[model samples]
Target: MATAPTPVRHRPTITRTAGDVGAVYQFACPCGATGEEQAARRMALVDLNEHVLSLPKVPAAQQCRTPRTHGNQLWEPCGLCADQTSLFDLEVS
Candidate 1:
């Protein structure tokens, strides 16, 4: 008997780019879904967070809370706070 091949999974990547006024962020999923523009750096991260969080396929644990862009480097979770808390902390400020 032959087995079926597993499907490929692609996560969205949020990239920060400099804008005419200020820093801007654009997130694009492998499926071609794009995120909104945010003036504030943190706000941009929040937009990316919300996009991924809304997806039914992504689990709570797998969702990154404190995502940071390291000076044109890698984008990953900072592991400082939980997904829920991090969102609140960033928004409340």
Candidate 2:
């Protein structure tokens, strides 16, 4: 008797939004600083102008909430967000 082949499952893809890309910034420690200093020395993941320019074309997978604030704009809180409040039990002003 011949057995039927199983079907493959497809995963849904996430879409990135302009707000998501601008939410948080990433940084690298040059002096290998730890603790509070590390956070202070963090750099922007993407340039201000560049980030704004690419916002419209961002991918879905890269979309998410961030603590970064631009002018009067506000973003949702998430683990990766720059805002301390969004970072688990960390407090924010």
Candidate 3:
């Protein structure tokens, strides 16, 4: 039986300052298909927070990827949505 590969362990870059800190994380999820035709999708970006980053602990049935950017070192969520969670949880996870 075929199985999905394990999540990649990334050594994130950490920066600290009087104001706040942030890190950049990058990963790729492969498309489910056969042969060379199957392409690998990718995600990457920088998430900033005063604390740390984390994500919920769940077994990934399929690979996932995300990318982010920080226009200002100040570091804040792109938008405010009730459903959206903080990057702090995402970075640690």
What are the Cα lDDT values of the candidates?
Answer: 0.54, 0.28, 0.27
Per-residue lDDT tens digits for candidate 2, residues 5-77, read 3312111122222343353333322223112111111233233323334324322222234414422222111
Q: Candidates 1 and 3: which is better by lDDT?
A: 1
Question: What is the C-alpha lDDT profile of model 3 across 1-93, one tens digit per residue?
Answer: 133244333333332223223332333223221111111121232231111244323222221222233221111222322124433345542
Order of the predicted models by lDDT, top scorer first:
1, 2, 3
Give lDDT tens digits, candidate 1, residues 1-93: 122234233367778888888778777777577778766667766766776666554234333553443221123232333345456555552
**Backbone clashes in model 1, listed as residue pairs:** none
- Residue 43 lDDT in candidate 1: 73
The residue pairs found clashing in candidate 2 are: 14-60, 15-60, 16-59, 16-60
Give the candidates in order of TM-score, highest first.
Answer: 1, 3, 2
Best by lDDT: 1
The model with the greatest TM-score is 1
Which residue window of length 10 is worst by lDDT in model 3? Answer: 33-42
lDDT score, candidate 1, position 75: 30
